[model samples]
Target: MKLYIAEKPSLARAIADALPKPHKKQDGYIEVAGGDIVSWCIGHLLEQAEPDSYHDRYKKWNAADLPIVPETWQLKAKTQTRKQLTILKKLIKQADELVNAGDPDREGQLLVDEVIDHAKPTKVKKQNAKRLLVSDLNVGAVKKSLSNLKPNSEFIPLSVSALARARADWLYGMNLTRAYTLAGQKVGFKGVLSVGRVQTPILGLVVRRDLEILNFVPHAFYEVLAHLNPNLDQDINSQTSETFTAKWQPSGACEPYMDDEGRVLHKGLAQNVVSRINDQVGTVLSVDKKQKKQNSPLPYNLSSLQIDAAKAFGMAAKQVLDTCQNLYERHKLITYPRSDNRYLPKDHHKEASQVLAAIKNNQGQEASKVDGANTRLKSKCWNDKKVEAHHGIIPTVKKLQSASLTKDEKCIYQLISRHYLAQFYPEYIYNETQVEIEIAKGKFKTKAKQEVNLGFKVLMGKSELDSEEKLPALIKGQKLLCFKGELIEKQTQPPAHFTDATLLAAMTGIARFVKDPEIKKVLKETDGLGTEATRAGIIELLFKRGFLKRQGKQILATESGIALIQVLPEQVSKPDLTAVWESSLSSIAQKELSYQHFMQPLLQQLSDIIELSKTCDSSAFKSLPEQKPNKKFRRKRKTYKKAS
Candidate 1:
């Protein structure tokens, strides 16, 4: 019998449905019609061994033995998942061949491969392992994918890269966390100073934002506006000849009026400029008309989906991921959701019409609005060169009703479906008009935009359509009336606190924070800070560990969080080290570099960080209070008085 293992039960069940007839169900696996057995893994069945797993001596955290680097890595099966492992091991012993049917990514390849390695069956060995990669879990797709299984060795580099990443994380997280926590212990700070490759850099983002918000000083700025009425031709309608407002623009020698921050700092000068331009008839110096087109956005990658979902429905990043996963796995309504690539393989274009037809048949009124995208429209989203392991999240050919989905599921599904449908729609077209007027040697400007077509905006719903700001027809020499100029006083705001949307943005493009150009370039070339699948969890970890908290939607660093950054060296908190390591991981994946090459420098850096921790002072965290004692005390004299 051949054993086929999947990443999740839903995917396994779907594959089973595609196989030939007569199948028997067991406790942990299904004997398929094709003399093969299908089983499933609940994500990762094995994890990296903890520090205590290396040796008993490492159980206790000590400053002397700070950098704990294991010579050979160890793997331990998750206790909760041991029963499934037992089932897999039994099947492995009975089978002559095995198939690795995990998700089509680095982590997925490693997840199932590690489990098989743990079982250590002599007959069912890695030499005979086959890989089954399928983007969709539908019956036809599964059957086609199974017929074309390749040797698992083809993906060795990906697996090695993932292992390198996991080990590197363990080295940094374990050694650095122990080092800092021990350092803090000596200074009366009673908490685990948890650190991570991605987690610390992200924590630095919140801490820096908190500091900026705390130190910000409000400054007032002023702007001058004029209400102008232009002369209208007799042929024009009376309603179309209405007046409009224009802002006073600093010109010629008035450059000093604005400061470096783009604020008009001198309020008196603004008032004087306003007074000079007041009641002055200005000729329209120029009227510029330009037609512009905004193409539909590319489909939803996990990060963009998370950012958009957070904005639209106030869903947290993890919540969005969970919902999308549910739609992908349980509902089988969409393709893989954990993808970072937003572009589809060029060959996938053949299936576009079928997916559209499925949508047109299943979706009711919403489908009618998508008639524009129903045709064979070529899109930039279909570029094989740009696609990686998986494409953007898109609805599968499976037919499902919006009524069948939950509220959150419905919203997320709509978001995914609309983006796909938008690919076939024409670009949103509009004309922009800019009018510049001159009055008393000062210039005033006003701009207007008129929509030529709704295009893709129609699928986004009626409210999302752009509204036109009508401007009266004017000639270059036309003169207009100027009402009394008014000064609008406003205060400059500090950088807004990071919400889930903004924080994810920062985490995705962390190169913006790095000073080193080489590190910044590498971070951009590889995955920034964290994978899309892991970013939400990192932020959630910060919240769970009490290092960060939410004030409304804004993320704020806790006292413990701020103190942790304060005590650590800049190398630990900054993005450069982690980003450089991430670039090395990318190199391993590309076969451009080896694991030994990557780990050597990382291990050396870990040792250096440990050494740095020994000399680091933790007195900066003296003000941060630890958990207070819960026990309350009473005097014995009270009991004596009561007895008397």
Candidate 2:
């Protein structure tokens, strides 16, 4: 009998629908015609065994057991899903052929492969297993995937990479967490000082940012503006009187009075410029005009979608991920929600008509915008080569069931649909004009953008519109009169606290925060702090651990969090180490690096970190508040009133 093991129950049903008809659903497996069966795992059926699993002595936290590294890694079935695991084992033994149908990503590949390994299938059956990659759950997409299966062995490296990551995190987290917790306890702080490869660095980022904000000192700065009018015939007053304001561009001679960022540091310098240029005749030095076109934004990747949702609706990252999952799994209104790629497969262009129609039917008030989209127009988002393990999140061809969606689901679905629809719209066109004028031997510059065509901006709403001033017509060497000069004083402000949108943006583009060029380049090429499937969860975990708290919409580190970061070694508190590990993992996935090659150095580093944790100064943790023990709530029983 042929057997198919899917990643989850919904996926199993989708796969069954695409196979031969006459399906019989059983308690844990689905039987199809022609003696084929399909089964699924509930997410991950197994997880890495905890430290205590290796030895009973390790169960209690102690500094002596620091740097606990397992000689050989082991997997243990989760208690909640043992029944399903048993059913899969029996089915694997009975099947003549097997297919691994997991999601198209590293974690997905590892979860199903690990299950097959634990089941101990026949050598030939395991070696000859087929792989199915499905990003969309619709019947048509699943059918296409069924016709194009590859050998599952080809993805062993991907699975190995995931395994290496899990083991590495286990070793690092267990050893360091125990080591630090012991240290904190010595300092009279009782909380569990948990540390992780990714979560620790994230906490460090917040703690450092909060410190910077607290230490910042605001100072005053000065600026000069010139209001000029066009003198077409070299006349002081012309019949055509249109005036424009230009900002002062300090000359090289003004360096002594400016800051590194070119902001005027002295009030007297700015006042002098204003005094010299006020009510003086000036000459237009240069006028540059160019027409430009801006293509519509690509479809939604999980990070970009989360960022936008946070900006537009004040939604948290976890909330957005949950809503997207509901839309993808329960409603089947959209494709994969955990995609990191923003480009679509070129073949998807063929289904534009159906997707647009579905959007029109689903969208209530925004239906009119769909009519204006030209289906023939193709944007740069349709690039087959740029498509990664999963394509961008988009609306499926299936018509939306509006009544089944929640308010959050509706908002997210509309967002995905609009981005998809924008692909068929024309590019936004505009004319950019810049004018450079010379007044009293000082330079002044002004820029303006005029919209030639609204194009995709119409669907994007008013946020994308360019609200810059539109410059009047001017020519080089043409005369102009400076009506007046204004001196403006402003204060230099410290950076704003991290918000949901900005924090996600920072994590997605973490390279900007790195100082080392090589590490920065690597982080730029790979996903930043964590994978798309895990970033939201990682952030939420910090909140649950009390390392992060929310003040209004801003995310801040708690006192305990700050104390932990201050006590930890610099290497553990920075993103540089994680960035390097991410690059190595990507190499392992591509078969360019071996699992041992990545883990060997990590093991050594883990030992060094554990040793440091044992002796690090714990003074910072002394002031931390006492840890509160968890209180379990119990229900009260009601007494009968009949006696009264």
* Candidate 1 TM-score to native: 0.90
The number of the candidate with the highest lDDT is 2
How would you encode candidate 1's per-residue C-alpha lDDT over 1-644 as one tens digit per residue? 88899988888888788887788988988887868999999888888887767886665666676688888889888888889988988887778888899898888888888888888877437788999887788887788788989999888888898999999888888788778766776767665668888899889888988899899999888888877777523222456557778888876576677777556878898889788877778889999999999888898889999999889998889999999888888787788898888898777777777778766665622857656664577778989888866788888888875558788887888888888888888888988899998878788899988878877887766733245456888879899877567888999889998999989988888888898887787787876888877999999888877888988888899998898887788888888888788778778878999999999988888898899888898887666766221111022222212221
Error of 2 at 224 (Å): 0.4
Candidate 2 ranges beyond 4 A from true positions: 232-240, 463-466, 626-644
Model 1, runs deviating above 4 Å: 119-128, 232-240, 251-257, 357-365, 463-469, 475-478, 623-644
Please, what is the TM-score per model?
0.90, 0.95
